[model samples]
Target chain A: LAKTTQPISMDSYEGQEVNITCSHNNIATNDYITWYQQFPSQGPRFIIQGYKTKVTNEVASLFIPADRKSSTLSLPRVSLSDTAVYYCLVVPHSSASKIIFGSGTRLSIRP
Target chain B: GAGVSQSPRYKVAKRGQDVALRCDPISGHVSLFWYQQALGQGPEFLTYFQNEAQLDKSGLPSDRFFAERPEGSVSTLKIQRTQQEDSAVYLCASSLGAGQVNTEAFFGQGTRLTVV
Candidate 1:
């Protein structure tokens, strides 16, 4: 199992870019880094995922360095609606049985 | 439905009672997952099924918790002799493929369980 560590909370102004980083020191070779966003009373939504380097989607981008020990989720031009709990999950590609989540970073976008 | 659907969005059960939560995965989806999320906490893995076969259940906290996907599309999570600690939002997710790639997992609004 690969565990993730991230900031407890973050605050950013609207229209600004916000970045949340998660550390997974013991990630396995077959593991991949994925990020999810969750709003109040709703389930988590997939934001982005990457094995290494960068993965860009319509909503967010995921950057992974060569070490694969840490990954960053970048939200561009965030708005008040972007406020939510961001979860970083490191799951092994070999098995999807353990899609674990940490405390997650609570992102607050203000005006 | 468009995504994973959970029944009885809100459930209240007495202590020591038995309760069952239902999850209807997307049509043609091969993988289904169950998670438990506590207040102010992230979702925790509970169990996973790959086409009616329970491939992994290592995340289940106790023996009282049981889940089954009989027809490969509908899943039910049953909690026997529920406790206060069992109170949380149960989430269901479905993916188009197995756990071999970085595919997308669609989640539901989740079933909020309150054990009194």
Candidate 2:
């Protein structure tokens, strides 16, 4: 399992774009970068995922550089409801691999 | 299409009491996982089951914790002799495939366990 480092918290105003970066220096070749968002008392929801380059979806976009050592989760036009804890996970492409959830970045969107 | 679902959304137990948390995964999902999340912290893996077989349980915290998926659909996590430190949210998730990249997990509302 690869350990990930991210900011403990981040604050952004409504209508502004927020980008959270995660560092996984020991990321393996078969590892995929994925992001999840969790609100209070609710289950974590999948935001986006990518292996390399940029992958955009209706909810968010993931940008992975060529080295795959780091990835960025970009949330466009944030709102107060967008406030939640965002987790970045690197999971292997094998069957029944362990899923480790590290400390996530708490995103606070101010109105 | 229903996502994962858990029972007893909130559970309060006394010290030394036993508790059972249930989870119903999505229909036809091959992989189901159990996780424990402390207050203000991310979730930690507890165990995993592929169909009715428990393939991995290394993440289980202690011997007092046990989980089973006998029918391969509905699962239960049993905690014996609960302690105050056992307070946390127990989450259940299911995915279409057993491989990581092949499928993404769909989580349930989770059971909030409070030991007093």
lDDT values for all models? 0.92, 0.93
Query: Could you tell me how far off, in angstroms, the CA of residue A106 lies in candidate 2 after the best superposition?
Result: 0.5
**Cα deviation of B98 in candidate 2 (Å)?**
0.7
RMSD of 1: 1.1
Task: For residues B64-115, write the lDDT of model 2, one tens digit per residue.
Answer: 9999999999999999999998999999999889866847889999999999
User: In model 2, what are the clashing residue pairs, if there are any?
Assistant: none
Per-residue C-alpha lDDT of model 1 across residues B1-116, encoded as one tens digit per residue: 58889998999999999999999899999999999999998998898899999999988999999999999999999999999999999999999888836678999999999999
Clash number for each model = 0, 0
Best by DockQ: 2
Clash pairs for candidate 1: none
TM-score of 1: 0.97
Poorest stretch of ten by lDDT in candidate 1 chain A: A91-100
In candidate 1, residue B58 scores what lDDT?
87
Candidate 1: Cα lDDT at A21: 92
- The per-residue C-alpha lDDT of model 1 at residue A79 equals 97
In candidate 1 the C-alpha lDDT for residue B31 amounts to 93
What is the C-alpha lDDT profile of model 1 across A17-107, one tens digit per residue? 9999999999999888989899999999988888999999899999999999999999999999999999999878865465888999999
